[model samples]
Target: MAIELKDLAPLLLKAERTNGDVDPSVLTNVLRGGRVANDRRKELLQVIERHPVLSDRDMMYRNHDERYNFGIKKAFHYIKLLQEGGYTDPVDQQILYSAMGEPTAIEVHRSMFVPTLENQGDDKQRAKWLPLAKNYKILGAYAQTELGHGSNVQV
Candidate 1:
């Protein structure tokens, strides 16, 4: 099944809990890729000093429009850095997405399917089982409903 944005919101909250909100220093590192020298740090601050706020979508949009494109640009920058750093495997991408909460759907896939396979499938079974998951050949969902033997959902 295709994933929906509504289905992924909780995972984003979980991600913030799991990874903390995005760090300003991490953005600096993404731009410069090393410890900022004293002069560079001042320059960075000077750049921000003129703006009342910082935004994540500066790469894609004409200006800082947070709602539509924050994750898009941030994910773009992240994937570029990861490719530069030579971690190109799909599993590596999954892990990075799980850690950083972007490309919007990978975290939902991980939170739903990864542990489900590990806990609900057998050992040799899981080896064969996980390939589909890693490749997006299979899709999964996490549902809470007021039905069956499970507890109720208010909504």
Candidate 2:
């Protein structure tokens, strides 16, 4: 699906004309807290949407293993892409994580493992684990309770 600039010219012109004093960029910057943040956000969205693997078009149909495999592949590229684009902010990572579909190791790594390490690990341990976790060398997850505990806890 190739779209030519001319094909969208009319819509773009209409939007520009109707925009008035709105200065969409201003709103965008304000929403993101500043121009730099907004630009990073737009860049992130473009990267994710343009990447073939990051998409979730036919995800629901995939079985658990298939989905997990796709997620692992995406995770590798996710780190590479962000690093290539010079975005090291964890906030940006959170944005990308939230954009993706179907729960995966990345989600658990971010929402659980990272926090657990940060809160519980000592400096020496963190020095060893953080880099691997940061580079997606090792992915992890945390479940709410131990297997036997289930949803019932007497404590």
Candidate 3:
């Protein structure tokens, strides 16, 4: 599978990175921020990989609605697995989102909702809303693209 590197990637990345410097695990740990972070990421990836539902394979042949709905199912199981495994950090949540490959329907929760609360909402507001947001109780979407400058989507 790696045969399509086109020779430029090796030069750009250098042979040392591919086969020298330090152990690959060590490099992965360092790149992932630390040992604990690396282990958590590995655990999450393993959880995704071992399960058939979480795999991204065979998605090419499915219809849009099929894929979308399957992705939603996967997202639900994805969170359940992580939470059940004792993961609480928001950073760990990115593992499932990363595997999603593109912007899914739940993109707003991660991109806009969390940032909006963290940046603007006071502690009381966050305390009341963040749990629901975190647990997917209130799935929000950024619908700004659907609203023109004059439109009032608030209602």
Candidate 2: stretches off by over 4 Å: 1-25, 83-86, 143-155
lDDT of each: 0.55, 0.77, 0.74
User: Residue 59 of candidate 3: its Cα lDDT?
Assistant: 66
Q: Across residues 1-155, which tens digit of lDDT does each residue of candidate 3 receive?
A: 36566867768678657776688788888998999988878777776677777666666788999988876777776667666776667777788667655555667777898788777889999998888887777866665474667756675
Q: List the residue pairs that clash in candidate 2.
A: none
The candidate that achieves the highest lDDT relative to the unseen native structure: 2
**Residue-wise lDDT of candidate 1 within 1-155, one digit each (tens)?**
99999999999878876787778676677765555543444553443333322323233445545634655455445545454656546554544444442234344565777678978999897888787765555756676656664675455
Tell me the lDDT of model 1 at 79.
44
**Which should have the higher TM-score, number 1 or number 3?**
3
* lDDT per residue as tens, model 2, 101-148: 555547778778878888899999999998887777888766565547
CA shift of 155, model 2, Å: 16
Segments in model 1 whose C-alpha atoms lie over 4 Å from true places: 1-95, 98-103, 147-155
Alpha-carbon TM-score of each model against the true structure: 0.35, 0.65, 0.69
Best by TM-score: 3
